[model samples]
Target chain A: MPALRLALHFIHRELRNRYLGSFSGGLWALFQPLIQLAVYSFVFVYVFKAKVPGANAPGYIPFLVMGLWPWNAFAEGLARATTAIQDNAALIGKVALPREVLVFSAVAANFLLQGIGFCAIVIAMRVFGVPVDLFALPLALLGFVQLFVLALGFAFLFAAVQVFVRDLSSALPQLLMLWMFSSPVFFARDALPERYRGWLDWNPFTYYTEFFRAALLGAGSFSLSSTLMALGVAVIVFTLGYAIFRRLNPYFEDFL
Target chain B: MQSPVLVEARRLGKTYPKVFHRRDRLRALYRLLTGGPGIDSTSVLRDVDLEVRAGQSLGLIGENGAGKSTLLKLIVGVLTPSSGEVHVHGRVGALLELGAGFHPEYTGRDNIALSAALYGLNADEARAKLPEIIDFADIGAYIDEPVKHYSSGMVVRLGFAIVAALRPDLLITDEVLAVGDESFQKKCVRWMEDYLDGGGTLILVSHSMYHVQKLCRQACWIKQGAVAASGDVFEVTQAYLAYQERKSAAQPVRQDSPSHAQEFYLIDLALNGDTADVPLVIDQGCRVGARVHVHSRDGREPVISFGVARADGTSVYGVSTEMEKQRPLRVSENVYTVEIEFPELALLPGSYLLRAHALDTEGVRLFNTLVRSITIRGESREFGLIRLKHSWPAANSETNVAP
Candidate 1:
């Protein structure tokens, strides 16, 4: 977070810049998650009568948020960061700086909005039945560590690739959609077949989403091995991604 | 040494490729699919080397294709050299494009933060400088409004104010000052003077020689992607001016007239001072004489009207003598001579053009003329706008020395 201070400032400026005259105010940040959560909760909890997978699941509402909230946050963060350099062609080409700053800022901004949505769910759980677990609070910090690294990796990869092959921009939504269903969003990860379960084990989002749900549900149930695996993957991907981006980053303005 | 040379560029060059299409769009498609060279990205700058010390101002002057702007981009690192390097020390806050970091949808307050962030300011640091920047920008209530609603002057003022408030070590400014009103331009001049007085370096590029002479101590005049002259401001400007004059005189001026197949018409007209051997300033009001070569259709005298025009191609003053009262004094082919008088010059410190018109002695329409590109240096600042004449005071005022 200390390293990302400049990045976060840029992110805050970017949010204000995009929504400046829209009249939605702070509602601009809360709108997308609220609507998406409401619609999916109706379809799954009401229509399908699905039960919460955790031991002390508050109710359908909190359970529904615990699943889709992280998925949506990761998806939006990746989307913004992926196109960050390409979308800001003017700033990238005209202004002199490290272009990675733009990508980090874009993803960081979307992550903050999603963070707010998660806080709302925690407040709702307190009002209803589920109690707040203080021990789970520190565990949630570990969740963000993974999310931050994942965002950096994807943003760096997409930003470099998008500069050359613009087709990535048009093809991203389909890719993100596929990634969303893979995470334990609408269904529990345990329900999948044993062989199919290995697929979620390797996917980094699995660790983050499951950890987020477990942290909000209660403490002691959170898995340490999965979070550790997530951190390892983040380290490898980010280091490789930064190496590639820095090597190719010099000529971005030339082609742009 | 003198602040240890803040910026240095050696053998810098940039080439932009050009894209062109044939009569068929399919050819464009073929090139697009095949990936071949286009019209742009041609080498605009070649082997340019420069050194800039802190607090040393340099004026960059050049023609449209001379690569002045391309060099600026390279210096600011907006562009990387096709080959070579630009070594810059300390922070470089480039005002290359005014409001370059501004988002149209964002308020002025937001854009200031955005620009500050681009300059490597943290959120808290940007917020700390916000009040000073807002006050300097001085648009009042409009600062809370989106920048799209701001006028060009407001945009320029805000941009200038921000840079001035957060003065960087080396400030690179392009020709952005021509955006505001007269008073605002004055304010900019004062601000620039103060900025320099505070030991800040400024590299300015402007089409106005008045500005260069008034501000820049050293100047570089570029032509044809090369340095034509570089030295003191006045000398470099004079060399640029003299080069333009020589090149213009080398061209054969062609008058573009209606080509509807009319009778014999005029082809070209030129004005020369009677004292061509000894040059004179326009303030002294030299005797302007002209030579006109007329090819007539029939044996008849043609009356001619001549004019002195402003530099913008608008005629300011004109005179025409009576026509055919003295008819039949004519010729068919070859050149003729026309002379005009200017007892006094009535212009300011700028260039002017001379255009001529020809008609029959009876004032019947005959021919139009080709205008010559002319240069007229005005009176020095010691005199007012026009050469109204002046004398030194007997005691020379505060000098306490009498002539």
Candidate 2:
């Protein structure tokens, strides 16, 4: 609880310091992803005429929203977390504290913003007459936790590397963009070629998206086998990231 | 039972990889991960051993880049030593760098809580100490303002305030007093005195010997990453001061006459009548006399100039025989002897250079310079280059006497 309180204070400071000065302020947190979703919708709905396997054109927006919101949270969390140590180099070089607090606070701030955006998207889905299963909310929340754990794993790995290699901060966003496309953020998994569809089994985001889609739309490929696989991969990434982070934590002050 | 040692560092050293290219850093990290052969590293600190008992204050004195800060960091566990080990017995509160852990965007009050938490204070304890920290900082309305808006002195004030409130068993401070204003520095010193009186162990790093001698019972002088000297505060500080003077005195400077000055040349320069090869050293309030021997090509009385400067090249005093209208006493046909005696040299304790120049009788045109180094030793802790003759009345004396 004390750790949580400290993380919360850092999260509050991070959020307020970054967005409070802008004209749109905290609204920008919601607006950025909405704009991205709108662009994706325009390209898919009008240009590509993309169709969901179980939903019509009217239901496709909510399907995309369910996947896109979690992806935004995961991607933003990792990106911010990677630079957490570098952003606080001054403090790290001086005082001794749990360096993990820096990475957790950064990820948590973005996660909170994504939660708000997810609520907005769910409300908009209801207005559009799309399915919104209140019973499936717990599953969606689990999917969020899984995403957070995976993002934290990557955050620990990258944040450790970033102290030595500053170029990682610049290169990671492009890598995340590529990763987002590889996952089923915009298109349905069924739409992929049969050869490539097998690769989705390897992509952990694929399972995460399936869980979220199942919770919101009740039409995702979520089964016991897939859930176990998701949990397995989450544990691996978390453990590996945490190990790498702890191993490299000592040399952080040297590089910074 | 004997109290446990508050801090102990045994043969500690910290080596940083000589990282130039990005690949070198990566290779070093890879080595760290795989437990492979280490990449080449330059040791910033080497073979440093220190121990501090409970309620004892140790001062670390060194010039900049001498690894004082690194030692402090290693002891406080902010930095891990590359070799050996550092064991600290209790909770440590360190003010390593001013405003180090503060968030610029957060209010001073908010930063106090955050920093307190970083210092291992729980939520309730941090909240409980907030009012006391605020009162100590006394930044007035600025406490509500963002930290970035606060001045440097205000930041140190807030930082010292937090550390004061924490009252950790071991306190490590690095040059925190060097930045703040005089009164705030005094306040910090007063607080530290009280903290020591309350049985707090302290590790203080500072360039100022006055503070170290005043606060610490033991002192360590680090020179080029090694322990040059360590012992009682007075002995260590004085030895460090003597070493510093000798180092400055050894700075390369042309002491011989120039090759082109053929008309007249200063053959020799001596201080305090000591013509030996060793440097001249004297105590404060003692006479310092410079003897200059000038050889004249044409039997003309050369205008001999005598000047004294501090080691840092600041000219303190200069005089010329031409300006004083004083004639040099002739030692022989062409060799003239001029002795300038400064009765009761008022120079403070520091290294100084005595320069004697041989010029034409007109006190202008070509010349040659001969230099000699001198050191003044004094126990008086006075400031500046000169020891002025003065006295202060008794503290708060009501009597007004005209003597």
Candidate that scores best on TM-score:
2
Candidate 1 lDDT score at position A152: 82
**Residue A211 lDDT in model 2?**
82
TM-score for each predicted model, relative to the true structure: 0.80, 0.85
Angstrom error of the Cα, residue B206, model 2: value is 2.3
Per-candidate DockQ values are: 0.34, 0.52
Q: How high a TM-score does candidate 1 get?
A: 0.80
Tens digit of lDDT per residue, candidate 2, span B1-403?
7668989899999988788887988887888889899879899999999989998999999999999999998987889999999898888889988897888878998888788767667778898998999898888999999999999999999998999898899999999888898888888999999999998888999887768877899999999999999998866876777777667557756566455337788877778767654457778889888888888877788999888898668899999998989999988888899999999888877677788888898989758887777777776666678977776664644465544
lDDT per residue, candidate 1, B1-403, as tens digits?
5687888988877775343433223333233334555424567888788888888888889777688887888888877777778888877777766666677777898788777877877778788888888887678999999888999889888888777767888888888788877887888888888888898887888887767767777888877666777877766875676566555556644556633343335544545533231222343355556555554556345667767675556676776656323232243443344556565565545455666666754677656665665556533442222355657665346665555
Interface RMSD values for the candidates, listed in order?
A: 6.0, 1.7
Query: How many residue pairs clash in model 2?
Result: 0
Q: Kindly report the docking quality category of candidate 1.
A: acceptable
Q: Over 4 Å off in model 2, which ranges?
A: A1-3, A55-58, B1-3, B122-154, B253-266, B281-329, B334-403
Best by DockQ: 2
